[model samples]
Target: MAASTQRRGRRIMMAPEELDTFLREARTCRVATVSADGTPHVGALWFVWDGTSLWLYSITRSKRWAQLRRDPRISVVVDDGEDYGELRGVELSGTVEFVGEAPRTGEPCPELDVPERLFPAKNFGLDDMPHDGRHAWMRLTPTAIASWDFRKLGGL
Candidate 1:
């Protein structure tokens, strides 16, 4: 992921360590994709952050998947907190690259090892990943990342 050179809200930005922790713990993210006709679609998905990249396991037949196949550009937001002052989130935007196979079925791809381990452990508390033939991997190493922790404002 490319570093954010955000100039407007430096005070509210999460430090690198804080961002990593947040992404690791967060459960669901909203993925935004554009169709060939320029229609925008957003859907919630389970993901894993491997310190450097975000991995999305998506159903190959889904709308989001179809749209991404047409156009790889995507934006993802992982956020938490109910109140204004408590809000914090990360926005990652870039193109996604399909990893492994379409509708992965436990292929021996060394590239998937880390995320395969991390995803189940974080989301399902499992020692190993269970592969459903419907889902496959997409990796987004963001071109730009912007994060904010409103909690850092100290109730202002």
Candidate 2:
């Protein structure tokens, strides 16, 4: 059997349940922003989808935080590891807002000892790594949403 590579430009969808599932299953998303010189910047961030909205936290001193402070416009990507027909992901473009500091629930994890942050931290390493004193929280509001899943059911 020949494999077909189905393609579409904007497969954006906004169903409450589908969004929730995507958030639950995916761990990391690539965040894109613009620098002062109009160049594009991208970084991988751990994020959590809280039902109606997506919540992400960043430290105060990072360059991404500094750039985002000036420009709130951002693009986010969430996906899996599969190739070709088995690919799945969600791309989001939205307005960003800088909130207060990222808090720690209790004692920090041992991974916090590693300054490089090479280990997993989140429920499935799909979210941010909480450290001793990272910057703060940056929230993205979805002005537009696009999702793709080669699965047959398509989140039904």
Query: Per model, how many backbone clashes are there?
Result: 0, 8
- Backbone clash total, candidate 2: 8
> What overall lDDT, based on C-alpha atoms, would model 1 receive against the true structure?
0.94
lDDT: which candidate is best?
1
Clashing residue pairs in candidate 1 are none
lDDT measured at residue 118 in model 1 versus the true structure, 0 to 100: 96
RMSD of each: 0.9, 9.3
Report the lDDT tens digits of candidate 1 across residue range 1-156: 476576778999988999999999998999999988888999999999999999999999999999999899999999999999999999999999999988999989999999999999988999999999999999999988899999999996
What TM-score, computed on C-alpha atoms, does each candidate reach? Answer: 0.97, 0.69
lDDT of 2 by residue, 5-40 (tens): 224533434244665687765668898989999999
Question: By TM-score, who's the top model here?
Answer: 1
- In model 1, which runs have C-alpha deviations exceeding 4 angstroms? none
Clashing pairs in 2: 12-146, 27-126, 46-127, 46-128, 58-136, 59-134, 59-135, 60-135
- lDDT scores of the candidates, listed in order: 0.94, 0.62
